[model samples]
Every structure is written in C-alpha cells, then in structure tokens.
Target: MIQLHDKQFVPFISAKEINFAIEKMVSQIEDDFFDETPIFIGVLNGSFMVVSDFLKLYKKPCEVSFIKLASYEGTESTESVKQLIGLNQDLTGRTVIVLEDIIDTGNTLEELKKLFKSQNVKHFKIATLFFKPDAFKKDLKIDYVGIRIPNKFIVGFGLDYDGLGRNLPEVYQLKEE
Candidate 1:
C-alpha cells in the first residue's frame, strides 16, 4: 500500500498490464489511420505520461499537441470543465485524435466536443488509456479505450490525488477504510 497525503491506496494495475493495454489501443488506431497522418491532442497534466508512452509505441508519422483542461478537485469530478490552454493549430478537414489518460465522468470530453465542433475538422476520435463505464455520464462514443475499470477512485499512472502519485509507474485504487 502507498499513501499520498491523507489517502492510502493499493496496487490495482501493474506497469506491464498498462503497457499491454496501450499497445492494443495503438494497434487499433494504426489500423484505422494507416493511410493518413492524424494529429493527436493530448489532455494536459494527467495525460503527460500516457502521451509520452503512446508516441514511443506508435511508429507511424503523426503530429501531437496538448490542451489543458481542469474538472477534478481531489478525487471527485467537478462535472464542469474549464479549458486552461487552447489549441492554435488549423484543424480544418484534418483527422484529430484526443488522447486522454482517463475517462470517468466525461466532463472533459464534453468540453473537447464543444471546442472542436466549430473547427471544421474532418472527424475527431477520443482515445483514453483508462475508462470507467459505470462513472461515465455522457453519451459520447469513445473510439479507442485501453482498459475499462470500475467506478473507483484511483491514482498513479498519470492519475493523481491532490496532485500527487502521477510519477508512479503503476496504478493504485483507493484503500477502503
């Protein structure tokens, strides 16, 4: 078990498992986007690790950018996403993929849809390393999903609790009291 601040967590997903999941997701993306280059827009903060690893595994030619959004406070989603960093690229008629570390409440995805709808992009796909179907409240279709987990608060592997545990190589779930 590990403690970050006042919360304790137990190991949930190992590094090897995480990498395997990512590879599968990447393979699926490669199949769909082999003919043309796709621009990957990574959600900042939590998606840093996911983006780095994803790029390393993906050999095809592609471009990457980042957009920072905030919707979580501690372990809970505020259900309101605020875009802190905006995209400056011309995404008109381009294939854009939004890389996210996790999709729980789908608040951030909602914000992304609103941001890209007016950009005239050919199409946009959502790729997330982790997903919580039970917690997802939005009706959006996630194109690529690495893993589908239960509705439990977790940290590590780019997910954090109070801005901690992002550096951990594996994932951990909140320990029950």
Candidate 2:
C-alpha cells in the first residue's frame, strides 16, 4: 500500500505486468511500422517512465520527443488543457506516435491533434499506457493501450498524485474509505 496526499492506495498493476504489456505493444508497433521511421512523441512527466521502457524494446529506426501538457490539479481534472512545454520538432513528413500515460476526457489529445493539424503532419497515432474507456467522452480512438482499467484514479509508474506516487513500480488505486 502507499499514501499520497491523504489517501491510501493498494497495488493495482504489478511491474511485471507493466513490462509484459509494453512488450506486447512493441511487437504490434514493430509489425506496423517496421519499414518506416516514426517519431515517438511522449507527453511529458507522466509518460517519462512509459516512454523509457518502450524505447528499450523499440529496435526499429525511430526518433523520440516530448511535449508537456496539463489539465489536472491533484486527482481531479480542471477540464482545461494547456501546453506547458511546446513541441519543437519538424514533423512535416514523419509518422508520429504519441505516447501518453493515460486518457480520461481526451481534452489533451484533442488539443494536440489541432496542433498537429497546424503543422501539416503526415500521419499520427495516439498511444496510452492506461486507458479509462468508461470515463473517456471524446470520440477519438486511442491507437494503442496498455490496459483498460476502470474509471479509477491511479498513481504509479509515471502517473502521479500532486507530484507524488509517480516513482512506484506498481500502479495503485485509492482505497475505499
């Protein structure tokens, strides 16, 4: 168990499970883009650990970049997204793959889609390590997902609670009061 802020959370997904999921996704990506060079765009902070592990197994010729966006305060979404760190790559003719920690309302991904549109990106896909299908309201297909978890607040392996619990090897969900 772990405590973040004033709540207690128990182990939800173990590290081994995380690695397995990543490996599973890597195989799919290799098969899909084995002959192309795709740029892996990681949404910062939350995707740090996920992107790290993913690249270790991504042997195909690819590049990586990061952009930071925020729409949450602690465990709740403020329902507004803002770019903290803007993207600085010339993605004019590249296949881009967005690596995200999780997707809830999809506001962030929508905003990024707009950004990519403005850039004239050749093609792009979204990937999230964790997905909350029940909570996702936007009509966008998250191209790849590590796990489809219930609409529960989770923290660990790059997800955080007010800047804590991100370093935990296993993901944990809040304990019921």
Candidate 3:
C-alpha cells in the first residue's frame, strides 16, 4: 500500500494488470481505426503513462500529441474543465483519438470533443484506461475503455494528487481518512 496526501492509504493496481489491460485496449483500437492513421491526442499529466504504453502496442501508423486539462482539486471532481494547455496539431479532417487516464464526470472529454468538432476534425474517438460509469454525467461515448472502477479517489500510473505521485508504476485508490 502507498500513502497519498496525509492520511490516505491506497493499494496499487500492479504492473501485471496494467499490461494486460493495455493489450486488450490496443486490439480494440486497431480494429476500429483500421487503415486510417489516427492522431492520438493525449490528455497531459494524467495520461502520460497510459499514452506511452498504448502507443507501443499500436500496430498501425499514427501520430501523438498532448493537451493539458485540469478539473480535480484534491480527491473530488470540480465538474469544470480548464484547458491549461492547447493542442498544436492541425486536426482538420484528420482521424483523432483522445487518450485519457481516467474518465469520471465526462466533462473534460465532452469539452474536448466539442473543440475538435469546431476545428473540423473528420473523426474522433475516446480511449480511457479507467472509467467510473456511476459518476459519469455527460452523453459522450468512450470507444475504448480499459477498466471500469468504482467512484473512488484514485491516483498513480500518471494520475496525481496535488501534482505528485504521478510517476508511480501502478494505479492506486485513496484511503479514507
């Protein structure tokens, strides 16, 4: 177990499980994208690890980029997404996939989809390592999902708490104080 913040004790998701999930997700994406060379837009900070591992398993040709968005304060979702960093790639008419570490409220992904549409992206899909279906609030669709987790405060595998613990090798859930 690992300690998050001051009083939380969280267990790690373990490397073995992470690897297996990535393999499955990659297969799904390969089948969906087919011949199109999709551009993967990774949501920064939280998605760094997932994107890195996912890219390695992708058999098709593709490009990778990043955009940063913030919505969490401590362990709770803010329900508002703030675009801390903007996309630099020209997505016009390109097939794009937004890779995210976790999907909770769906606010961030929804906002990104709208932005991509306005930029005239021909196609877009969402790929997330973890999803909290119970907490989801928007109508957005997740094309590829690695795991469905309970609505709990989680960190690690690139997810962080107050900008720390992102480099941990596996996912972890925060322990109640």
Candidate 4:
C-alpha cells in the first residue's frame, strides 16, 4: 500500500506486467504498419512513459510527436477536455497513431477527433496502454489496447492522482475509505 497526500492506494499492476503489455502492443503495431512509416502522436503528460517504452520495442521506422490535453482534476474527470498543446506537424497523407496512457470516459478521444478531422491523414488509429470499457462513453473505436481494466480510479505508470503518483513504475488502485 502507498499514500499520496490524503489518499491511500494499493498495489495493482506490476511493472513487469506493464512492460509485457507494451511489448505485446508493439508486436501488434509492427504487424499492421511494418512497411509503412506511421507517425506516433502521444497524448502528453500521461502518455510520455508509454510512448517511450512502446517506441523502444517497435523496431519499425516511425516518427513521433505529442499533443498535450487535460481533462482531470484530482481523482475525478471534469468530463471535459482542453487541448493544452497543439500538433504542429503536417499529417497530410501520413498514417498517424495516437498513443494514450489510458482511456476512460473517452472525452479526450472525442476532442482528438475534432483536432485531427481536418488534418487529412491517410490513416488514423488509437492505441492506449490502459482501457476502461465500462466507463467509455464514445462510439469511437480504440484500435489498440494494452490492458482492459475496471472503471476504477488508479495511479502510477504515467497515470496520476493530482499529479503525484505518475512517476511510480507500477499501478495502484484507489483504496476504499
């Protein structure tokens, strides 16, 4: 168990498990885009760690970029997304893959569609390290998923609780009071 500020969390996903999931996801990506050079667009802050690990395992040639979006405050989602950083790369006729740390309510995913709707990319896919199917509200398809988890608040491995436990190598689910 661990404490971050006033909340206590228990060990959830291990670091080794996280690495294994990432490797598996990379293999799937290689199968689909082995010949084509796809550009990876990581959702920033949370996706930094996932993107780093994914790129290391993916041997195929690819480009990388980031778009920072925010939709949470403390342990709850604000139910809205705000794009803090915009994509500057030209995505015309290029295959683009978005890497996300986690997908819950899919509010961020909706915002992403709007942002890229005008980019005119040849193909676009979404890849996330963690997914909460029970909580997903959007009709959009998530192309790649590393792990399917319950709709519970979690921290660690890039997911954070008020920006505190993001640096932890393993994941921790919020403990009941």
lDDT of each: 0.94, 0.89, 0.87, 0.94
Superposed model 2: Cα runs more than 4 Å off = none
| Model 4 per-residue lDDT tens digits across residues 1-177 | 999999999999999999999999999999998889999999989999999999998898999999999999998889889889999989999999999999999999999989999999999999999999999998999999999999999999998888799999999999988
For candidate 4, the 10 contiguous residues with the lowest summed lDDT are 74-83
In model 3, where is the ten-residue run with the lowest total lDDT? Answer: 3-12
Per-residue CA lDDT of candidate 1, range 59-143, in tens? Answer: 8999999999989999888888988999999999999999999999998998898999999998799999999999999899999
Judge candidate 2 at residue 18 and give its lDDT: 94
lDDT of 3 at 66: 95
- Point out where model 1 deviates above 4 Å: none
Which candidate do you rate higher for TM-score, 2 or 3?
2
Q: Model 4 has how many clashing residue pairs?
A: 0
- Which has the higher lDDT value, candidate number 2 or candidate number 4? 4
Q: TM-score per candidate, in order?
A: 0.98, 0.97, 0.94, 0.98
